[model samples]
Target: MDSRFVGIADLVETPSVAVVVDVMRACTVAAWAFAQGAERIVLAESLDEALALKARHPDWAALKDGPLAPGFDMVNSPGLLRSIDLAGRTVVQKTTAGTVGALAVKGASLVLCAGFVVAEATARLLRTHECDSVTFVVTGEDGQADEDLACAQYIARRATGAGTDASEFLGRAAASRAATELATGVRQGVHPDDVALCLELDRFPFAMVATSEGPQMVLRPCAATSPTDAASI
Candidate 1:
């Protein structure tokens, strides 16, 4: 199998599987959501759009990050995510990086979200796919972030059956600007605990897979136990 990393803007390859890496928070929040039993996640481009969807489905959880827009359930945060119950509920998420990149992917048969927390599990799921190429879409603000690049590399290596050191990748991610913001509280209102939460590795045994449902991109948890839902695209 061939594996390589590409930024969101450079999504030119029609890979068998595409893994979107937003390790700083977005994908991490998604992994956490699935781990907490969220029924599914909806990716929206803007706060207004997310709010509109929420208005239509009040019971669905609404969340947005990057300045923390109003008229939503909470900021895209894992600490707060842990406090809220998401079981059997559809979650709508708007982010500058993660969700946008996820929705932008048109060449991938199977789309997935990843962070350090679930990087390995995501890789295992990728291994289950019967294909020859995989792309890791680094969905950073500028289409590239140190944390996201490191994560993509780590996941690619793991999925390709190559020995990799997780700490090296985790350390590179923790040193990213986004991680620094969380630690220094530069990103006010977002908890510092989020830094630790997102950095912690291998938290789940399932993969968060996204599929297009009409105009909406729905993300659901897929167990990495075999060639299950994620392997089918």
Candidate 2:
């Protein structure tokens, strides 16, 4: 699928590769988890749900979630995630935006997860697979424009591998715009580190997928397991 703009509602009918973008947090965390050697990750839409999952499997997973400002065990800081030991461990994470977006794309034909951190890799996956269509679902802020749109702009370019025109500039433009938004008062607390984190390209080789186990949504290694093997993660 060539890169194109899309909405959260449109995700239901899109018969193509679905790349869920939650740049500020969720997707960023997924990339970090993979690099940290997390065997898999689970993205729950709400902190309460994520906590319950952790309670049920206390011996097997590490949990993280909470409001963004004070931060949580599963804080959205990309810097902190790098120091944690995740190899062979399962992570149950909850966030305000990204995980919710993953929940919405649960039934996509090919639900591939993405964010700024893996833009290059995401593009590679698209070029190699060349699916029927490509939809960049921006889980907007409270259903309004937020950092996800900027992240989506970058992913859209990567998914199509389009170099001419502004395809190459969308990501940079998005980040610049996000910076502008932060400065102009439309958005606040937009971290420079986070904006930079979202712009990093293809730092890892894997894309994440949201796995469903009953009512829970978890981010898992897309290449490592099938949906039927949800219990194993």
Model 1, position 151, has a per-residue lDDT of 86
Best by lDDT: 1
**Whole-model Cα lDDT of every candidate shown, in order:** 0.81, 0.61
lDDT digits (tens) for residues 1-233 of candidate 2: 55655667665474456778766556776788778778777776666766676778874454443334322345655655777877788787666666666677777666767776666666666666665567777765543454566666666665566663433444553555444654454553334465556556656656566556676665665432233333232
**lDDT tens digits by residue: candidate 1, 170-208:** 888888888888888787548758988988888777778
TM-score of each: 0.92, 0.74
Model 1 residue 91 CA deviation (Å) reads 0.4
Runs in model 2 lying further than 4 Å from the true structure: 2-4, 9-16, 60-72, 142-147, 164-192, 211-216, 222-233
lDDT for model 2, on a 0 to 1 scale?
Answer: 0.61
lDDT of 1: 0.81
For candidate 1, what is the TM-score? Answer: 0.92
